[model samples]
Target: MKNILIFGAGSIGNHMTYASIKLGHKVYITDKNFAALERMKKKIYPKRYGKWNKNINQISNSNLNKLNIFFDLIIIGTPPKTHIELLNKCKKMFKYDKILIEKPLCSYLENYNKLENEKNLFCGYNHSVSQSFQKFLYLIEKEKKQKKIFISIKWQESFKGILGAHFWLKDEYDTYLGDISKGGGAIHEHSHGLHLAIYILKKLKIKNFDFNSNIFFKDMENKPTYDVASVLRFSNSKINLVLETDLLEDNPQKKIIFFNSKTKIIWHNSFTKNLDCIDYQNKKFKKKYNFKKNRSSEFEKEIYHILNIKNQNQYNNSPLNIKYSIEVMKKISRTLKNAKHF
Candidate 1:
């Protein structure tokens, strides 16, 4: 079993810790503040996963040096802004086989440069690596051979859902979720839409394409100061994409659809709490593909995938590879800069 060190005890950190332990690995979770660690043990973790394992270690950042133990894998599950900072911190002190940074990798362009082509690094764009997505991709490959495709990715969901998940947050301002500059906004927060689009292009080996983007900003006395919605489009001859992510929808719509002259194909996440679905439609027939899995299963599969990585070739194929997420970051940079205010 691997020894995993997770930095940050927030929602994502708790998910990672639960994943690690469920996979029969030893886990150590730390945060900059002790209260965050306490929250994880006392409330966040036990509440989410039913019960916390006492074996999982909790170490504050100030006390991290006391660990002195080398880990097999390190996962940085902190906020988007602190990802790179904590990554650099981990490298200085820990000996590890791999490091996985949570999605949106970091907030700015400069944060990405330090990680360019880093062989041992990965990100947490977990959806693309999901079994449901794998099945969707397989169907896509078969369908694409017969016709060119058009893609639409929608990750529009209510901001209330995000806040509710954290439960402890008074509002978006309570965390980084309120500010775009800190990497919390419609585009960055819902970047799974962005990454899946990029992943499809990469998998199809699309080299060059034109991209245009527009974002709608939230108006709340200019307090939160972030984009509330985004629409991004990209295309070449064989394929086209229209992607949208927003925080304004009470009726959440999370799906990626690939369509052509005859067929309308879709992949849906959390269509219900425990199911992922794919739909296929044409003039004569319609079909549904369903996967039943718990919320933590994807995160667990992600850690399992990482632990089993034995070489560069396999790692490069990972959906969580930093390279794939780098493409996501570039797209996000362009999307946010092309913003419009409501």
Candidate 2:
């Protein structure tokens, strides 16, 4: 079994852990706070995965607890503010085959590029590598001959779901998510919508564009100030886009659409907790595709996508490639700078 090391013991950390073990890796997970690791064993993990996994090793992260094992993979599943710091520490630890940093690599985009050229590095925008999106890509290639006029994406969810899963957090203010400068804001947290929209744009060969946003901020005095809602408008010679992300919606909505007056295509998430759907429509008829599985399976598919990398060229070209991630971050950074706030 290949050795896998994961940082952090929070919600994403727990998901990655379950996925790695299911894939039969020798998984070792760590957190800076020992209590967090304790919760993973006693509270967080079993509550989600049904039982504590005996095969998984839980360790406390510290200079005194240095790991001597060489890992095949390392995942930085910590907050955006700590990704760069933890990544550097991973480099100094026993050697690893590759490293995957979770989404929004870091806030303010500071030093975001320092390791972008690292050939073995990747960013986890898991949706980018999903089966539903792959099917969409295939259908899109078949759709190239059709005139494309408009496309829009939405990823709106109440942070209650986040706090509910990670019940330890009292509220948004409990984590970096409440602070825009630290990268937990709506646009950054929900950028999967942005990433997918842009990924399809590249597939369509749209290079030049116009972009702007209407951002709404939560500015409680002495509390973390963040963008709670955002609506982005982008256009090019071939397509126009209206992408929305927000933390205020009671009904969680996540979907992407591509359309002309006569035809439309949509990819929707969470139609049910275990299902993702895609719809294709024309004047004549409509077609639907559904992919259903437990939440753990999403990360399992993502892990397989990472393990299947055959070479450097493949790594660089993979949907998880850092270049594409940085491009998305740049757009987010730009939108935050230019957006008019409410």
Candidate 3:
């Protein structure tokens, strides 16, 4: 059981804390917002596992100077703007081996470069860690061997305020969208798509591609942050990604549709949290593929994979995943600039 320290009390932070305690680990959570910390404490104490324990500590910019405890892992879960400051503080307080951060790693290219120089640090893009997405990739790989492919994603945001801001805000929203200086907009949010695209292209050895995005959100500082649509063109493939993040929409729909020249395929969440894949061939024969749900039972599996807890499958390269994430960020930066002008 590792001692983990989490630095934010947001939704992802809460989930990470829950997952860690469920694995029988000791967790220490600190948040500058006392109210958020209190709410988290109340929500967590009643649901904790028998072997698990947690301590909620209040921290602030001034009080942070006194914190000296060395934890097995330090998770930075704060917003994008706070990343660099927190990273610098962590570098001074703990060894590089102890840090793990969330998506878009550092908020800016300069900060990312600074963090890359640190030794023994492990930063990951958590979306790729999802069992559902991994299974999706596996299936895509199998399909690629058989025929040419095309992909389409319609990410409906009827529930716009929930997970939407957490992931998509950096990409489509105004406050962060076009502002490369501050890490705003779709590339930040939709970067997972970019990463997945690049991963598939590399695997399939596809060379040529084109990307286009239409931005409909402006004045993001005082308004809702969301995007209209973005499109991608690859060798023998074209992907249309529609993001409906407007606050005016009452009922939001989120779905991903993929098509080969011959058949249409739909991948979605199942009733049991597993992934459901349906294949339709010219409205004639339909087949369904239900992927086994490993995320729930295998929460520790990915962590163990990352930590090398046992003899696990080693990735072909040590930092390939991190490099892929950085590449996606670069693509996102380019996409954001184009979207801002349009």
Candidate 4:
């Protein structure tokens, strides 16, 4: 059992704490809002995660400056805007071999170069570790080359659902969800499609690429963060990639398609954990592949993998590691800059 310290007790933070404790590890969580910590304690600690013998403690942000404790791993689960600042704080206060930061890593690239090359640092791109996605990779390896790839994602869900699921999202306007500067948007939040596309290309050993995007923001009160349809295009000498993201769709959908001139493969994965794939050629061949439910399994497996890392070089080369995320973030930055806005 490892002693873990988690900064930020928001949605992702709470989940990480629960995962750590469920795996029989002690967790010390820190948050600026004491009320949020108390809510997590009541909501998570005693019902679904109570029976574990491991201890769970909440440390206020003010007290973090005074506490001196060594943790096996430190997870930065705050918003994208706060990651770098909190990370700098943890570096001073803790001695840890591994650090995991929640997705999007950081909101901006201004200070990205200042970050150290820490081999023990990993980002939470859990989709890269999903069994279904791995199987998709394995299946696609049989093809000599992919001529084109297309992905469409619709991440529409109710505000009430968000509030119910993540208690910290009660005040939608105050939370990071309503602020574009803090990495709020369909592209930033539902970025599994973007990362997975990059992951697939990297896994297939295709590197030369260029990205183009057309994005639009929702005209709402307070701040107008983009929630409407957006088109992201990626191209290289070998392939043409097209991906679309939308948070305003009435019926949500998530899918990916890989095709050459003659053959095409489609993977349908939305709310359902089923990875239903159909491979076909117009009149010659058609095949259907079905995978079982393995959503929660990815998080469990990712935790196991992070804890077992012993080499810095290995982490640097990991798909879910900071190096790749930095590269992906750079591409995203480019896409945003060149986006065609309405």
Clashes of 4: 0
Order candidates by lDDT, high to low: 1, 2, 4, 3
Whole-model lDDT, model 3: 0.54
Best-fitting candidate, scored by lDDT: 1
Name the runs in model 4 displaced over 4 angstroms. 44-54, 65-67, 144-164, 167-171, 270-296, 340-342
Clashes of each: 0, 0, 10, 0
TM-score of each: 0.95, 0.95, 0.70, 0.85
Task: Give the alpha carbon lDDT tens digit for every residue of 144-255 in model 1.
Answer: 6645789889999887788878998999978888888788888888998898888888777777888999887775884878778888988878888899899999888889
- Candidate 4 C-alpha lDDT tens digits along 181-276: 677666666676777777777777777878778777776765646444567777877777777776665455666777766666666663363443
lDDT of 4: 0.69
* Clash number for candidate 1: 0
Candidate with the larger lDDT of 1 and 4: 1
Q: Write the per-residue lDDT of candidate 2 for residues 254-339, one digit (tens) a residue.
A: 88887877778888887788888899998999999998867888898888888879798888678888878787877877787786
lDDT scores for all predictions? 0.85, 0.83, 0.54, 0.69
